[model samples]
Target: MTNKVIQRLGLLLAAGTGLWGQGSMTVTDAIRKAWVDQAGLKAGQAMVDSRKAEAEGYRDLRLPTLTLQAQGVRTNEPMMAFGIKLNQARIGMADFNPLVLNHPDAIGAYGGSAVLQQPLYTGGRITAARKAGDFMAQAEAASQERRKQETALAVVQAYFGAEVAEQALKWVGDTETWVKGMEDFVGARVNQGLMLESELQRLKAFHAQVDAQKAEVVMQIRSARSGLGLLLGQGPVDGALATPLEPGTPAPAAAPARRPDLVAAELQAKAAGEGAKAAKGNNLPEVGLELGAGTLHHSWSQKGDWTWAGVGVKWKVFSAPDLAKARAAKAQAQAAKDMQIFKEQQAEHETRVAREAVTAAEARYAAAKDALAAAEESRRLREARHKEGLAPLIEVLDAEAAVQGARTLILQSLYELRVSRASLDLATGTPIEGVQP
Candidate 1:
């Protein structure tokens, strides 16, 4: 079989599995499929998860820290030997002798300790850090939502682009059939001396042109399908799309809502502010409480155990680096806030532009429909006249070409209208395929 037939068979087979199993896949189905399988969106979700995990870690900073240590040592040094004997509670009256104290025998001691340290105060550093982490996680989650919307927008474009190519190809096929019939009619007329040989040759040349156009359109259709597959996180797909290339109706425009990216920026700004506070907190004093219990044994028969509790304060009196870091963090926070404001303004502009584009697309689609109607009527009249021998074959051919051109234009305008409507939804932060951003 020819490549075209093989391609068609491949499409039919693909339609028998997965989402396509229900029949030709619709635009909504394609968007949902891409949401599940697209690698970029998966990566975005992973980043959000990672941020949440980090935030959890930051929140756990308030808990106490426990450390356990074990040590065994033998020393012949007089001072160490005396200390070891004292710690093991094995000191003897003989150890008081100057001769023994100056020249002590080797002593061995084993010790173990468990220490717990709880923060009493951290100058708000821990709180700020936790808040910053939470904000970062929220920001990442919002960013992921924006990524989903962006992915949905891409699926819409690729899906409809394939439909446009297929529609054009269908019209080209009709034109080809018409030209073939004309070629046969002209050839028979030439044989009967009713039509010139040059007329038949002219008809044959137009037929070649139509065939060439069909081949180009077929390539376009193949390319669009491959691109759609890539967006869906699959390799080349050859399934028929159920979504038709019809003009999209414009929805009532609502005031633009805050897009996910804008929300992300706002959250990121808050996170930066918290980060600055955390950095500033580094300059303040810290306080903590520690509780420890330990045991020391010189021999199995002679052992000493003790417990202790204490509180400590730590202050960095003058650290130039800490001061600089705090200043830098504050500056960065301000910059982030400023950037968020700029993005909000830019988003407003984008929404306005997108709405205008939708309106223009709708108008163009309506005009194309009217033009197609006129072209179809003209084609019918020209063909009728040619059949009655009142019009030239060339006028019939031209009329057919005009009708095909008009049909192509209508398809193009309808595709644009669909895309523009989708773009408007994207700009307004509207949900796509019922997926909330």
Candidate 2:
């Protein structure tokens, strides 16, 4: 085929659309334009913020809590109690002073308390809590990266799908035109008594075949348009008026080791290890600081005061086979690590295979093109010979069929190469430099 035919295929693309730009969009633009809707991205960001909040809350475990106390209470009976040390002796006594009483029979309640307590030590409980929060935050980050990778892959497939379908449609259109021309030429020969009626009938059958091919191409084009729309976070079959397909070379190295999904997997594996560490650390000491301000109404007729402050430490005295549980967590982490490695290996292998496939497909397409060119030249010679009365009509007809068949094979081969290149791009997790920021 000539460049003119390829140019016609592109002319149908909306010039205003990303699909028909003078140059194909960079991978970064395609990813953003096709995937990662604003709403979904915002939601992802909110999740990250939530993770940060959780981390911050856990960080508070290492700091003392301070609070002021104030309370208004009325109680028919004692609502709360605290023992007092009188003269170095612990005395169990209810202060029934009216100033603290909310009602009769209510333990006397008094002044408000300003409570403050700092963690003395926790058997690694606080540390584990904090670490867990940190791990969660890290996981959230990884999840975001994974989202990016997923979107990129989706865009790659969809964008190229549209491009391929457009190409197919154009090729089919051109072939149909050529088939009609052949039919006309054969019919003219028959009218001139130079071709048989059966030959004319054969041309009609060929025309019918072309019609069927056209239908298939139309369907394929519609499907591709839908796929592209879906990637852009829009309804299928709703591609913008400006949407168009453009042809270009895919940069093989654009996919790098830093594919977002791969990076995310690595981070997730690390987070899993952190979780395992935190789980094991649960066996150690945990320190806590508690501070509260609240008042108790001790009397039926009197108001109560608020006062509070405390600090505490906890040591996990004993547990049932915690070692086994911790070991399980470690094992889980190891499994995650293995999975991450496997994913990387899989991506690399697929990329290499895709590269080879693309090369092979290209070779096939080139061979097919050459075959079609040869077939066309042969058909031309036969037609000339038949006009000169030196060749039978059958020979010309056969030559035409060869040309058409070769054209179809050439188109199919080119399509396969494009599809394989797309697959390779998806496999490699696209180059880090090609990724959107």
Report the Cα lDDT for candidate 1: 0.80
Residue 422 shift from truth in candidate 1, angstroms: 1.1
Give Cα distance to truth, residue 289, candidate 1, Å. 1.1
Local distance difference test, candidate 2: 0.61
**TM-score for each prediction?**
0.88, 0.72
Backbone clash numbers for all candidates listed: 0, 37
Tens digits of per-residue lDDT for model 1, 140-182: 9999988989888888777777777766767777778888888
Which residue runs of candidate 1 sit more than 4 Å off their true CA positions? 1-22, 75-82, 93-107, 247-257, 385-394, 433-437
lDDT of 2 at 140: 83
Clashes of 2: 37
lDDT of 2 by residue, 174-205 (tens): 76786677678878888999878997886677
How does residue 219 of candidate 1 score in lDDT? 67
- Which residue segments of model 2 deviate by more than 4 Å? 1-29, 38-54, 63-117, 128-132, 139-143, 236-257, 292-294, 297-309, 321-324, 386-401, 419-435
Cα error of candidate 2 at position 394, Å: 5.3
